[model samples]
Target: MARLTNSMFPSIPSFTDRFFGGNLMDWNNWNFAGIDSTLPAVNVKESDSDFKIEVAAPGLKKSDFKLNYDKGRLTISSEKSDEKSEKNGKEVTRREFSYQSFQRSFTIPDDIVNADKISAKYKDGILHVTLPKREEAKVKTVKEIKVS
Candidate 1:
């Protein structure tokens, strides 16, 4: 009978493939060096009297938020940090620290928005901002003219 050789089984992987393993794509890897992907969601509504803005940010205290308005621009930002440490007989056993921050800005129409009447409140993990409109900006009633 003829001698059987490796060429007879061409479907089998080579030695390098078995030793180094097969190349596979990594789907769970993430890059953190750029802008953060975690930003609070927000909703905005406009009515005849005012405009409303709601931001969803859970587990944050009211004092953690800062709101600023200048030159018809409104900015909202928050920063928080927490640090914990445990010591046993002057030997630190465990330590943990965390920090988070975000900022969002909006532009208000100068002739329509009344900056002095703007108000904000935080309740139940929601930040509500009310931007009152100027009197002239309110919707006016339709006038009917009688033709002679």
Candidate 2:
């Protein structure tokens, strides 16, 4: 029950029950902040010979991504520019797409003898990295000889 003010000749009671009061603003805020983020996926694979890494980033060109290597740290980053133009008195009504960037880095182990020989390629919405292993890392065979 809600108490009414005596200043007015007649007091008006709130139509809502105290136990069932609704705050739509709070609900809206909870939903907005609790929403999950949608980000691209990445895949990595390695063998005794080489390592392969692929990242899924659609609608991005090769020029949008930059790679840098310093002190055994490999960094990959992507950035995009917004598109805004009005030509010949044309009116645009709606815009729904959003553009954001991300960067990732990894520490290359000392066992990787030749980091300069690494290569990368971007095609079909996927970025691929190839890191070849050093010759010393390969397996070898030994023959046994018997002495009489």
Candidate 3:
């Protein structure tokens, strides 16, 4: 016998994966009515002296984001609400409202990071966070001697 599967709704296991396991957004779950939610994707970069985090969140302003740092934990979150209505001289024709919210957290080793100098900024629909490394934690180049 052939097994039949529906594409609209995911299977039981996949439902848990999308709702609980996944840390980033999956477009298949995007919804306007708020039944399903979406999360922005994030990228983390590391260099010899600093670490950078990039968050991709479109259709949002700088005021929509909130960041918090506590006990070596860095948390980033955003919440936004929008309302639109079509009115004809005091009579409303159509109205809609939507709300979005998401949170992400990372644990940073305090010994390697300079928490006091950490900084973040949002530009071009992307959020950039820079974590400066401690002097002792930064990588140092070692000179090599040639053998005769």
Query: Residue 20 error for model 3, in Å?
Result: 13
Winning model by TM-score: 3
Give the least accurate 10-residue stretch of model 2, judged by summed lDDT: 29-38
lDDT of 2: 0.67
Error of 2 at 45 (Å): 1.0
Clashes of each: 0, 0, 0
**After superposition, candidate 2 runs with Cα above 4 Å error:** 1-39, 85-98, 141-148
Measured over all alpha carbons after superposition, the RMSD of each candidate to the real structure, in angstroms, is 13.3, 13.2, 6.6
Model 3 over residues 88-129: C-alpha lDDT tens digits? 999999999999898989888878889899999999989999
Cα error, residue 126 of model 2, in Å, equals 0.3
Error of 2 at 5 (Å): 35
- Colliding pairs, model 3: none
Show the colliding residue pairs in model 1. none
* Per-model CA lDDT versus the true structure: 0.79, 0.67, 0.81
Output the worst ten-in-a-row residue range by lDDT, candidate 3.
Answer: 29-38
> What TM-score, over all chains together, does every model reach?
0.70, 0.60, 0.72
